[model samples]
Target: MSVLELARAEIRALVPYSSARMEAAGGATLLNANESAWMPFGDAGLGCHRYPDPQPAALVERLAALYGVRPAQLLVGRGSDEAIDLLVRAFCRAGEDAILVQPPTFGMYAVCAHVQNAAVVEVPLAADFTLDAGAVLAAVTPAVKLVFVCAPNNPTGAGVSLEAIDDLARRLAGRALLVVDEAYGEFADGASAATLLDRYEHLAVLRTLSKAWALAGARIGCLLADSEVVTLLRRILPPYPLPRPCVAAALEALSPAGQVAVRDRVEVVRAERARMVVGLGALPGVRAVLPSQANFLAVRFDDAGAAYRRLFQAGIVVRDVRRYPGLQDALRITVGAPEENDRVLAVLGDGA
Candidate 1:
């Protein structure tokens, strides 16, 4: 079955909101939406007087080129979080359908499911925090409509191989939409799941500039899927999803020089990730440092609470991920600047 056919019938039948921007493409005089005729006093380079494009053309084309996808197959949203919410809203009917996610992964999947009043089916990752494909397939009941897999999973940093993902896609075709969230793909090794889009029409890939590109404040992200799927989600998105200033920032970040700087920084993060893993693992109070391809480490300490407080006392903030299942003694620490990383090592190393 086509992915569009899997979306809620109500969504497919509903007419999308016709915004002022969508109505007229060419107009010198702005009076359609009753927006302010004059530009603001502190007008930045990008004029905020007019509503930005629903999916800004220049930004969309730039992101599509960067991710190696056509513009028709991509949808720009607030972030990966918005894409997740939109997916759940489009595919799931409240109290009828469900979405499946692997535990110790991104929490937004289940949160969106709950918000939609849809059931959340969980298949816990293996001991090493890898995808358990068989368990996932077995857990896929008729009610499940979407499956979110975070490549190089969050909190744990274990990635699912392309081969494993291919097998899952083959098996789950026509059954449900397989969404591969590559929020940390730039830091990890190997090609993106977007490369599999042509082979599996039911697959969608999520990417963001928050991590490697260092545009977290801008909140720019893209959802790459089959052209039909992209069209379907656009029906439910806001009139103007991206702000003008954010789009300007994203475009600048995607420029050649910005990209080069991003690459250099990623390499530094990779090196620091390695250094932190070894340094943290050697601490007297530390139990283990999970190896990661992402820019962060999931570290286990003899006394996680103590370690968390110690870092805070030293003015360093690390995520306390003890509440996540199977991570009671672990804290998630992100890779920072050389001196910042040194601060982390020192705080934990000083008789920690």
Candidate 2:
């Protein structure tokens, strides 16, 4: 069965709102959508006077090339967060269909599910924070319409193998859509699950510019899947998703020179991540440092509350994820620039 079959029939049948920008493209003299005739005082050529394109062709084409997918198979939006919301809104039915998630993972998956009145099923990662394919498959029921896997997962920084992804996708082929969140993919060692899209029609990959690309403020991201899946999402998507300046920022960042710079920065982050792992492990209060394939490290300390207080007192900010399942004693630290990292080390050197 097609993945489209899993989507709410109401959403599939409803017509999405069509903005004036989508219907009419180019004309020097503009008079549509009730847009302002004059730009803001400090517009600086952003062209904020008009509504932006729903999916700018250039940005979509650029992202498609960058991720090794076709334009038709990609849907760019505010961020991976928006994509997640759209998926839940379209697939899961209120109080009926559900979304499966491997927890101690990204929180947004569950947040989106609850907002759409969909059930959230947990198939948590192993004690060691590794994905168990067999365990995941055993938990899937007919009610599960979506399955979320976070590659180089957030907070923990553990990654799911592409082979395992392929296996799960194959097993869940007709039953559920395997959604792999690769927000931290550029920093991980594993290749993308997008590689298996050709084989599994029900698979989707969510990628973001927020992490490695340093485009978090730009709010650019995409969902890569079968072209048919992309078409189905468009039916329910907000018509004017990308703002003009944000679109320009994305285009500039995806430029050849921008990509070169991103690669260099990514390498720096990888090196820093490795260095932090060793450095953090050597700290006095740190009990354990989990293995990571992304740009951060999850370190378990003797006293998480004390550790958090010390860092903040020293004017350093790091995520205190003690509230997350299996992370009660852990603090997540992003690998900062050299000097910034030195500050973290110097401050935590005494072990809070």
Instruction: Find the candidate with the highest TM-score and give its number.
Output: 1
Q: For residues 1-352, what per-residue lDDT tens digits would candidate 2 score against the true structure? A: 7788988899889877877976766788778788889998898898898788788889999999999999999999999999999899889999999999888998999999999889999998998999988889999999999999999888899988888888889899889999999999999996899888889989999999999999899999999999988988898888788889889988998999999999999999999888888888888998999999888899999998888889999999899999899999999999989888888988899654
**10 residues in a row with least lDDT, candidate 1:** 37-46
Question: For model 2, what is the C-alpha lDDT against the true structure?
Answer: 0.90
List the candidate 2 regions with Cα displacement exceeding 4 Å: none
- The per-model lDDT (C-alpha) reads 0.91, 0.90
Tell me model 1's lDDT, rounded to 2 decimals. 0.91
RMSD of each: 0.9, 1.1
User: Best by lDDT, which number?
Assistant: 1
**lDDT, candidate 1, 1-352, per-residue tens:** 7778889999998899999999967777878988888789888656898888899899899999999999999999898999999999999999999999998999999999999999999999998888999999999998999998999899898877889889999999989999999999998988888899999999999999999998899999989999999989989999988989999999999998988899999999999888888888888988888878799999998899999999998898999999999999999999999899998888888845
How many clashing pairs in candidate 2? 0
